[model samples]
Target: MTRAALVTGGNRGIGRAIAAGLVARGVKVTITARDRAEGAEAAEALGCDWALADLLESDSLRQFDGAPFDILVNNAGILPSGSLLDNPQGYFDCMAVMVDGPFRLTLALAPGMIARGYGRIVNLSSGWGAFAEGLGGPNGYGIAKAALNAQTLALSQELPGNVKINAMCPGWVRTRMGGPGANTSPEDAADTAIWLATLPADGPTGGFVRRRRRIDW
Candidate 1:
């Protein structure tokens, strides 16, 4: 069977790389972006489908209703420069994208995946989300990802069959958010996501990983 995958914020960066990698493996990939033109351009370049969906806008997610994606990558995120004291809305926005958006999408898609008896859910988490690591990042970025990580752990228990869900830290990749000084490339950062996306029935679920190795939550 041809597998179908959905990747959010896949117009560029690690999300784009992961979409391309999945396309290479013959998976039917659909990428979402806030910008329609950029999303279409990337879809054309990657030879996959595209959609306009903003993580912050809950209504925009209606487009994905009933879509039975075998793999789902919740990769869209934002990093505003401010502490909670300075900008509370920025914190909420981060939660909307990094936490709430993924939660909504997962709920929408998981039912179909359950019926199919297979699924792979990968949330683009970060080391900043790890409590043992001090949760030190931008104001809401770390908090939102930590919430996402918690969601991953909670959801894993509910999913049935061969379906698996996990969170991944892509490291400091050179992207719009990561800046030019970051060490990892988008392709390199996508490696672990791709691995988790294609895991077997016995693979680990509800875990955090980086570079294909398990890491602390």
Candidate 2:
């Protein structure tokens, strides 16, 4: 059977690149975007399917609960809710977009994956989430990613032998959030994610990796 993949926030940036790479590999791809126009445009350009799903909304993922996807890339995120000192709304917003929604989506999809005896889950995490890096990103971004890392680890233990779940740090790239001066391009940042999403059954799980190599979590 042909493999299928769902890439969240795939209308642009690193998510977009991941979708493109998967399509090039002959995988059926469905990309989600909050905007219809953007999502449709991207799907047309990439020769794939598109869906209107907002990660911030609680029920946005219900529609995909029955889709048979061999790969899931949780690449959607937002940077908001300034300093932790303020205990602001954006902090919760960050968690909702980066952590909560992804977890819910995984829960909705993992069952089908297990029944099929094949699955690959890749969480797009960050160096900022690492204690070695001192949880450095602004706007609670670091905190949200750290929680995502924990989810990746916990899920790995429960997922079966044929299924693999891991987190990877897609290095800073020149995207909307990374700005123009960043050192990498979206496609370059997408390399590690593409690798993890297509790993062999024997590949590592419940680990944090960057540039295709294991890194401290």
Candidate 3:
């Protein structure tokens, strides 16, 4: 049987690349995006399934239909910009996406993953998740990601033995969120995500990795 996987925000950028990679590997892929048209187009291109769900809504997660996905990539996130002095709302939006969304989705899916006795969860974190240097564009974005890294470590320890959960700092990738001058491409970031999703049974967990090397939290 083919392994099943879901990639949120998979209509474009890093999420798109990761979904494509999983589909190419013969996994049954599902890509979720806020835009229905875009999500459908991406799913068609990748030859996979598609769904539209806004992370801010709890009902959005309930639509998963309880499928036992072998892998879940929580790549959906927003990077709203504002300085710490003037970004009050930005902080709330960041929390809704980077922190609350992932936490809820994982909780919703954990039982099925545990029951399967074989599962992989890859959370798309960032280099800023560890060290906070040079991340001044959006104070809320960096702060949310940093909290996500902590969640990854904490969640990993809570997972069952047969399931492997890890966080990945994909570095600064060239995407809408990464901006024009970013050095890396979505393809580069997707490599590590795909690697983590398809890890062997004995693979590492509760780890933060980039380019296959472990990084400090």
Candidate 4:
């Protein structure tokens, strides 16, 4: 059977690249974007389905209820500028999107995956989230990603069957969020995520990886 994949924030940047790559590999891909126009355009360009979802709102995710995707890419994120102390709402917003949203969606979809006996989950984490790396970056960004990584690890232990979940750092890609000077291309940044999303049953789970290599947690 053809695998189905859902990539959040896939209207552009790394998410879009990941969605495109999955479609190229014959996976039936669905992309979610906050903007209807952008989402529709990107879906048309990639020849995949699109959904309007706001990660901060739980009600918006109900649209995905019946479609239990085989692969879930939690790639939507925000890099709000300011210190965490001064920007409490920003921190909450970051956590909502990067941690809570993915957590809820995973819980919603995992049962179907378990019943089907196969699933793949990839959270687009970042090196900045690493404790060894000092959790550096825009205030809430690293903290939220760290939480996301933790969720990936914890969920992997609970999930059964061929379901494999992993967190990946796509590096600093030259996207709107990463700005124009970042070193990696969107395609290059999306590589490890694509790999994780297509892993075999024996593949490693609950690991943090970059460039197909393990990274410190």
CA lDDT, every model vs. true structure: 0.94, 0.91, 0.86, 0.92
Worst 10 residues of 2 by lDDT: 79-88
lDDT of 3 by residue, 66-114 (tens): 6678899999988876676787888888888889888888887778989
lDDT of 2 by residue, 1-217 (tens): 6899999999999999999999998889999999999999999999999999998897888898878889999999887745877767778888998899888889888999999999999999999999878888887899899999999999999999688999999988899988899998999999999999998878888999999998887
**Residues 39-147, candidate 1, lDDT per residue (tens digit)?**
9999999999999999999999987877989999999999988889998998999999999999999989998998889999999999999997889798898999899
Which residue pairs collide, candidate 2? Answer: 81-90
Q: List the residue pairs that clash in candidate 4.
A: none
lDDT of model 2 at residue 167? 95
Q: Which candidate number would show the highest lDDT if scored against the true structure?
A: 1
TM-score of each: 0.98, 0.97, 0.95, 0.98
Stretches of model 3 off by over 4 angstroms after superposition: 132-137
What tens-digit string does per-residue lDDT give for candidate 4 at 76-110? 99998899899888899999999999988898788
Compute the lDDT of residue 149 as modeled in candidate 3: 85
TM-score of 2: 0.97
Stretches of candidate 1 above 4 Å error? none
Give per-model CA RMSD: 0.8, 1.0, 1.6, 0.9
